[model samples]
Target chain A: MLGSEIPVFMTNRNTITEQYPKIYLYRRIVQAKLFIDANYADNIDLDNISDEAYFSKFHFIRLFKNIYGKTPHQYLIAVRIDRAMQLLKSDKPVSDTCYAVGFESLSSFSGLFKRIVGITPSIYLMQQQKIKAQIKSSPLTFVPGCFAEKNGWLKNRNFRETKS
Target chain B: MLTKMTHISINVLDQDSAFDFYTNKLGFKVVVDVPMGADGRWLTVSPPDQPGFEIILTPVIRSMYSKETSETLRELIVKGSFGVGIFTCKDIFATYEELKAKGVEFTKPPTKEFYGTEAIFKDDSGNWFSLAQLT
Candidate 1:
């Protein structure tokens, strides 16, 4: 009797499992995202990433977007742009930063950066430079020093009073 | 004239996971689970004792949002930027223990506030809700 019921139980379990297949798909999508995060700087592609997650490219794209709310390419671009923002904050040039962030062309990089970040790479660099300059030029209001007379605080106070 | 709300929507990161979180973990009942479009589902759930009201678990997908908007909303949701609303129970402590035992992640355990005894737990998509037993 138990042996006869085994296939029936398996069929019922499979039916229930089919009702919530997205949970398994969601795990595959997460694996794809982990791959993207680790290798965003490399020349990643749909075929390779999908293969890594053991999914077809078409199904992977739909499942990934459904689960993550962003397509794999969009997520990759977001990651690349984020890294580009950090690189651009330093002395890196826009052209070099573009390629360094995994974009093959400068124009496409600039276009995507503008669309997502609301500014072109050059403009972002200019803003970063302006921020850096402002921070550099701001006056220092406090300095650490000993307050004891031997450390010159009293002498400085006296000098200030005499000047005033 | 529109005095009572019968349905509300909560944007979630994933509909399937949200369904599991709401129904299994939070002890809500599935109200509806229908296909919305090719890539989306119209999923809703209700609290155990709340019969009429349903909370739709809407996925933040690109069909209803641009790429940038979807990205921004997903980021915010993952960062716990949206607090969906409040749910009330008769015994806050008991409900909290029950939900916690069911694997619900609570940001704030049950504590006595000025208004009531409240706890905070986030949905699967990172939107938080306050569970309170008011005085």
Candidate 2:
């Protein structure tokens, strides 16, 4: 009973049939964002992200930027910077945190970090340390070593110091 | 004291389109359509049979949310991750067929379940709803 071809109805500009493609485009854009969110820590590039959404890079980039008001690269950087902030908060060394957040080089990581967060990693670490020192009387609680290691945090202080 | 839900919100990708979808396809009645600010409207709609509760068709605009959050909400909506709620009809089969004729896309055709005869349909922005004739 459901196999028959339904006649296409077009009553107005807001018809669901007319809106389907636009809705599909929105879905593709969301898929692209989900892909970036899931793989932000990996070596993800624009081509692969667009591929994940089954759209051409140019089309995906345009739609993503139009819908989200930011380019895919900008979103990726935001995601990476957010991860880097968490790593830095946990006292991970600058260089380790850079690679852990998927930056190819220290210079690029530092440049973007300063551009976005308005400070270099070391300076940010210093600020975090100052905050921690102020709250030291409350007894610092470290996330368990297993969770730390799972998040790519170096558990050994000497290793972190040497890397820094 | 406010003890019951008088209004609920359903975030839509666009307010104008949502107005059409809810009013034209789903046969909801517009409750309010007043201007809110420079670019927003206080748009709300209610089901034909239910007038006391209004569903606010809020848009995911820049003024309402940050760019990241707006984008995230749009993503969630398009991914069909948000289920607005279940709507009850007198006859599930009749309602399902009537909605389908009105261009609503049903993800699941009417089926008999332990609870009732249930069907699923998606709105213009990909939010799904269960239209059921509960037992």
TM-scores of the models, in the order given: 0.44, 0.45
Off by over 4 Å in 1: A1-164
The lDDT per prediction is 0.72, 0.73
In model 2 chain A, the worst 10-residue window by lDDT is A7-16
Name every residue pair that clashes in candidate 1: none
lDDT of 2 by residue, A2-77 (tens): 4345432222213233223355565567667667767898988788878888888888888887755679999999
Clashes of 2: 0
Per-residue accuracy of model 1 over A1-164 as CA lDDT, tens digit each: 66677654343332121234344554566667767767898998778888877888888898777655689999999889977987888758999999988999999999999998899999999987875554334311111222123223333333322432
Chain A superposition TM-score, candidate 1: 0.67
After superposition, the stretches of candidate 2 with alpha carbons farther than 4 Å from their true spots are A1-164
